[model samples]
Target: MSIWWSLHLRRDAASVPLARRFLLGAMETAGVDPEISFDLSVALSEACANAVEHGGDRRVQREQSVGRDPWDVWDEPAGTACGQYRVTAYLDGEKCRIEVADSGPGFPARRMLRTSAQQHDPQLYPSLSAEDGRGLCLIEQLADHVHFGNRPGRGALVSFDKVLKWRKGALLMVS
Candidate 1:
């Protein structure tokens, strides 16, 4: 069986947990192993937090300057003027994929370089003391596959997937 869900959420702190909870509930209901579910949930939280905290304001300003309605471009509900982020998840067999996209300035090129450097030479790069920068690292460690990109003229996209392992006997019940 395959399951998928998408959430269009306001760029607010509260929305982060909402997204995480939805994912956790979905995984629990589907009998996804707790360990796999926990890892995905934490990664999802990081992604959502990045979107809410960093994705919206600059994009909104750019859209307004061009006389285009920002929310309209994203197809957000009418009357919702705030910036929005989207989270999507797909589960098929033992693989689960999740994407978090934001309408902010895309991931900085330098940060990507830094991440690469840190991965290759942790002693040289060390950990960033800045409030930001840890989320991508956490996501990289937790997900089996990770991809980063931009959304055309708009925002940043972070996608990650994990190959799940079922609890003993759970696979039989699912089949």
Candidate 2:
């Protein structure tokens, strides 16, 4: 059986846990091993936090420059027009995939390419004292496969997947 879900969320702090909780619940209900579910949940939280912190400001500015109100462009309800991000999760058999995309300025192409090449060395990234450097590292360590890119002139995209191993003798359950 396959299970999937998608969320369009405002770029707010609360949305991080909301996304994490939803994913955790889905995995648990499907009888995914707890260890896999926990790791994915933490990785999901990091990705969502990155989107909230760094992914929507540039998009809002671009929209305003074009004389389109960001609130209207995003169809966001009043007082909640900060910006938007998308999270998608898919589970098929023992494989799981997740993608987080934002509408802000995408990552710099040169830097992204370089970072991808050096992901194994955490020293290539800013120190933890810096406010915004740890999420990518955490995601890299937790996910079995990771990809980073951009959406043309729009925003950044981070995707990762893991192949789960069920606990010994755990009955396979699908919802």
Candidate 3:
């Protein structure tokens, strides 16, 4: 699989929708069906929103866009926050890939979930203390994979994937 683009942006409300359309269109342009576009949109939107809220401040958010370096230049720019969030949108033959990263202080995926959360919750609960926890949880439920891991000195990556499934459902797609 080849990653076409990895976008890095600040933690701002203004950029949320722009980030959504970027992933949605990338999926279609890579041959993902329009029927599931909404799913991808919702998942990616929430991931990016989490990055913005927990990742860093305005100076860090607005200045950190466009990069190819995975580690070297990643944290040098935002020393205050110590880690940056990244959204990698790419495609393979059968699946569209999206990853939202926030390399801040965090535990690995195994530790983050408890026996209580391991159980299913249809409503996808969000915490009252913070407005953003639900988005990642929802992404996990909706996307094929949602990964969370610490990125060395940075933070974590919430990787999202939606594999293209053929026609048990294409009766639902129009174009």
Q: Which stretches of candidate 2 lie over 4 Å from their true place?
A: 59-82, 113-118, 167-175
Provide the lDDT at 74 for model 3: 59
Model 1 stretches with alpha carbons more than 4 Å out:
59-82, 111-120, 123-128, 168-175
The TM-score that candidate 1 achieves is 0.80
Model 2 has an lDDT value of 0.78
Where does the lowest 10-residue lDDT sum fall in candidate 2? 73-82
Instruction: Report how far off residue 12 is in candidate 2 (Å).
Output: 0.4
- Winner on lDDT (2 vs 3): 2
RMSD in angstroms between candidate 3 and the native structure over all alpha carbons: 6.2
lDDT rank order: 1, 2, 3
Model 3: per-residue lDDT, tens digit, 1-175? 4446887765676677888888776665555576667888898888777777666532444355455354444555443343345677766556767877664554445535323466376543565677445676777777776666666656667776777643433322223
Whole-model Cα lDDT per candidate? Answer: 0.78, 0.78, 0.63
TM-score comparison, 1 vs 3, better candidate:
1
Could you give candidate 2's per-residue lDDT for residues 12-34 as a string of tens digits? 99999999999988887777899
Evaluated at residue 117, the lDDT of candidate 1 is 41
TM-score of each: 0.80, 0.79, 0.68
**Which pairs of residues have clashing backbones in candidate 2?**
none
Cα displacement (angstroms), candidate 3, residue 138, comes to 0.6
